[model samples]
Target: MFPERLKFPRRPRVRRRLGLGFVLGLWFGFLFYRPVAGLRPLREMGRAWGDERLFVRKDDDGVSSLSEWNVTGTYKGAWGFLDTTNNSSRFPDFKKSNGNSVIELVSTPTKIKGVHYVQGVIIFHDVFDNERTVGGAQIRVEGVYIWPFRQLRMVASSGKGGEFSQEDDYILSNPYHLLGVFSSQVFQESPRDKIWRRKNSPVLYDVEKHCNIEFAAQISRVSSNQNDGERDNYHLEGLMESPSVEEDGDCFSPLLLNATSLNIEVYYNKAVNYTLMVTFVSFLQVLLLIRQMEHSNTQSGAAKVSIIMIGQQAIMDAYLCLLHLTAGILVESLFNAFATASFFKFVVFSIFEMRYLLAIWKASRPMNNGEGWETMRRELSVLYSRFYGILLGGILLMYEFHNYIRPILLLLYSFWIPQIITNVVRDSRKPLHPHYILGITVTRLAVPLYVFGCPSNFMRIEPDKNWCICLGIFIGLQASILLLQHYLGSRWFIPRQILPEKYSYYRRLDQNSNHATDCVICMTAIDLTQRPSDCMVTPCDHFFHSGCLQRWMDIKMECPTCRRPLPPA
Candidate 1:
């Protein structure tokens, strides 16, 4: 908030020119030079060019096996198991490659740590103590979430292409088996191991819709071949994803590219477009205000201008409406955009300013105050200097740096909406002059709603932008008008009378003559009236003392003699 004593900055004549020149240069560079150069390399790197498949492992050798897969897609893989025993034992194999997963979450409870990338082979045991270890399987995998309580229970189905039934499936001897299996097969092909790893080897299976496959090593265990520990459970370790990992010839990088590009296209683009629309609407609004003030109109002329002004306002209102409706999309992406947040501020502040003007007008009415006027002055000063200051300033800052405070703004809106509704209900009760109410009702309420309801309104933009400038202009106008009104009210005389005849008896008195007279209102003799000049006459052809007349006017604008009210002229 600016201090009460703030003076508008007086920029040097050349400052504006320099600012415009700089902006033009920057935009020109962005549009012509940098944009093309930045995208040129991307063009040559054909969209279809990508790495083949990925691996899931956890050591130096296994890590290398998964590196090529990381070049094309991004994932986080984890291996955890649920054993079908009296107590149902579970183990989490923490081997990893591409440590960061596609789904990122920071949560409570260890089991729900979500997916992570890995490459490895494992064995599975049947109820008869027959162990099967699958080998030479190229693995590209991530975390396997087991609903702790539903570890053995079939949680859900992928609905892709699979089925399970109790009829013929009752012959299934391996009822104590794992589902929701993770493997590198989805991203890779042609395992170097031939005897076990084949496309139609029945490795991949669907149980209740989940795509899963038994590791090649698991089958070996069923054959009872005691394999080496390292060979028995293979694993690999790799990179943890971070911003520094710029796009490269990798699977993960390409997926990242798609996500990043989509976000920019949806959010930033809408912001810029909304900002432009706001500028245009603000320009039109300012123009309309100027025209309304300067143009005197007959019914026909007013109709014509009203049509044009209403059209422009309608367009702006429509865009504002759309911005409100799509707030989830725009705000979720980037909170602080001028279009998404500050534009609403513009609408709100504009309404407040209009009300402020009306309040000032009411305060300035001749019948409303005397010493009571100072109370109003204090009220207005406090209202504008603090509450309005904080509101408008916060809005301006929000518009400029919306992304940083988007979350805070969303929270604020929850509170602000109710407060606004309450205030609207309270302030709608003034006995407004007919003309004023008609004008305000038409301009403020009717037009905004109509505009928003219109689909093709001219002010339509992804986010509303015109709000900040519009709000500033409104505040400025209100303050200026209030100051001017104060000046005029103090200077202008409505209807007043000055009585000279009431002091006629003391006209002859002078320092040399040493004469005196009686007070006209009280008719009290006093030697102090060397020349009674405090008398005032009314237009009613009656005379009264200055003090008497001031008191009389305070109570009633009527003559003491005939009791006729003083003419407003």
Candidate 2:
């Protein structure tokens, strides 16, 4: 009942339009305009930092030109911190530089009469930028072929990317030649140049007269991707240093050495050793399997063998884990070790190891009671879940202190340890299962061996090689046993059922042929006309695909028809 004029509601169109306009302005200011503004300084910085030299001239248009620079003698090791060091102190008078954009080599050594040589592009980075971050040009090596021939051909290199240049022959007899060319027109020019923030934009280095060494490598093997002659495999930076101006060589420039390249050959060796170790362990696992199967059937000769193998396997597993954990510590490039060595991490790992040991000990007791094992499992599970929740929560909340990543890793290890223990313990409960026994035994042994080799630095204690070797042998024995049991299944004591060869492949029966309509055992529908390889019919008349039945039968021996055990062949 207020005055009609006062009761009328105001419209929001003007306010909505104003709000939209503000949002649009913000988007342009922050997202679009700001980035463009930053790029302006970035380009200027690139051009100002390096030389704009002309190396080649075909005509007045300057259609073909190359920039040249060199670094002779050892400049301040830190002066050209971002350039590759292959050309640094390693090569005297190393001159390496590249045009701002992509360049093409029109002729190779074969095209002109001369000695064969390698030619590759080199991009330069600013010294200040190099000191601040990891910066270097990407050198993509095209495949090297014989030079000093009539005509020459080049193609893009290949590996993950596809190969190029399938044509093989060279041109008629002539001189070996190599010509380099760059475009006169710039891909990026002023007026149309985009600007961006220095920090946000990629920092490019355009060096002047000084030689910039970006990377240095001490290689026992040269050109891992190529199998060319030894000359192509020179120690390092030979090409960057030797070229002259008449031959289109940039002057020697400073080379910067950053981090050292990893020894790839060492890694390859490690992989081989690791694989051999795995095979040996697998063999032992198989042996344990056979012993378990033998014991289940006769229970006469397998007890001692089983016990010994289990012990050996445990020792081996623990030792291997320790080796890896210790290696992780030794490699200090990453801060993970310091984090893992924290008090929290130590405590968590200790708790996890203790829980696993307890489970094993409880299971191995003379008393056949399983209550202790179950109790320990429950306790470990609760602690594991609780700690994990806390760790995850802390990390998610960004409350993960600098000190906590390591603790989390240890706690994570705990989760897996229990799982490993559970798998062995649960499976071993079957008594005659060799695979389960071997796994359990190995896990138990691994713990002590790991502890013995503790503090991997060998400062405290070192595992005897003889003992380790013995453990390896024992693991191999267990692996062999498992392989045998895998063939035997649960009824290793009972002779296995073997169907007629005719039933191996699935086949459809002819409508007129006298054939059983259902599986002999289960009475299930079976298409007789289908090949035996494709379908299988049990003795009770249940029909199924051979693959499906084979897989199912591996786990179950009884026929679907009568729940009767499969007949011994």
Candidate 3:
């Protein structure tokens, strides 16, 4: 027989104080985390690297060819120049048996505004005579010049045996003012500042004063002893173009010649696919969360806030996932732009995880305590605003540092792994509901994958065949886990019920008892005179409507009021 009225003990003050302190500590730790090293120097270094220019030359003497170029730029393996030149010299004299002088000029113009310019490898064929005497003739390269309001008209013809003939392409228009040539390898402050103010000339002839040129024999040669036969016997040259232009007149930009664009296409594709998959999982989790919230008897304000936060994150994730997928089909610049934006999404998601943990903490505590809901909500709002501001500031800092963001994110994710595992284990010990298990497992797996399988970092330097294979395996594993969770959740993880006689003791309500007139589960009055048989009492002496008590028992065999475990049936 249970007591007609039961009194529950109050939570100790020390425990509440400890919980608050722990939450504050977590918040402070995340807020104060900063990169150990300074970032300004790294940014300056990148800008300097981007300003370096590439110079290339080919002559009739075949000794120094296109196979001698060396690249020295910030975007190392991500971009380069391609040499498509056949081994034949483009020099006019080389075409005739009697002549020895040969020369060719190739240029690729890219959209340049200010300091930012499109970067790619320029591909061209080089031909030179093997004889030192013929190679001695210098093959000069005139510095890149901007043509204001003038377009060059050029014609090309295929020679016998598919060879490109040595023909000069000239502008059809009369004398047009040449903005200037980038004369020396090193220029004063800006390349535009080097524009020569001399009289306008139909053809540029001051090769020594206005162009950076190299003799065919002097170009760096690739040693035949260093590589296997399959190695691409091509020279590498670094090129950096400036966007500065003279605002004095209108200018028709020169067309880029034989420019082969180099970008991380495979990397972007992988990133899009990964984002889609993660978004799908997040959507599924949101649905599960909503369903749980609907069926849950714990209707605390904190619980509602948690559900809302998760829903917001799911929406944001879906939007960003779509943005990433769209970027894959767009231009290279757009692709790169979204790549940076995607990192912000990851940071936001990390912050959401912290909010989620706080929500869980609030939900686990007794909501009936005298704490003000309005005050808690206000505090949460303030914290969220601060976190967002921090994230925005961090993005600016990361953009400046460029190379440090990835490592910091990696470290943060590594730290989260243990926390996720702890949460999963703790949740698993409770009632085994399908949604609960699925949610926990997906979250546990997703965090680590997000940390390690991020496309930007994973595909950074162009992975080899083995790395691609490993990536395939990782994708397969993620898919398999998802399918397994779905199957088990739908077919085998139904909630179990506790037998009434085993965990609960029945007691009839009497008019004389204080709590006998009230149902604690619904917080409604129980009319003992009208329907006394509808009252049910648990082992902890808590009274609830019979139907309500049965439903609660099906979910968990514990006293609803005191949260005490019931005796075994």
Best by TM-score: 3
Worst 10 residues of 3 by lDDT: 172-181
| Tens digits of per-residue lDDT for model 3, 196-305 | 21132211223223322211111122345643343323222233221213332211111112211122343345455555555555555555545544444342323323
Give the per-residue lDDT of model 2 (tens digit) for 248-364.
444344332221122323333433343344434445544554454444432112211233233323333443444444444433331243233232223323443333333344334
Clashes of each: 56, 112, 19
lDDT of each: 0.31, 0.34, 0.36
Q: Decide which is better by TM-score, 1 or 2.
A: 1
lDDT of 3 at 237: 28
In model 2, what lDDT does residue 499 have? 21
Candidate 2 lDDT (Cα, 0 to 1): 0.34
- C-alpha lDDT of candidate 1 relative to the true structure: 0.31
CA RMSD, predictions in order: 31.2, 27.2, 33.3
Q: Estimate each model's TM-score.
A: 0.24, 0.23, 0.33
Between prediction 1 and prediction 3, the one with superior lDDT is 3
Point out where model 2 deviates above 4 Å: 1-109, 117-137, 141-233, 238-253, 256-281, 292-569
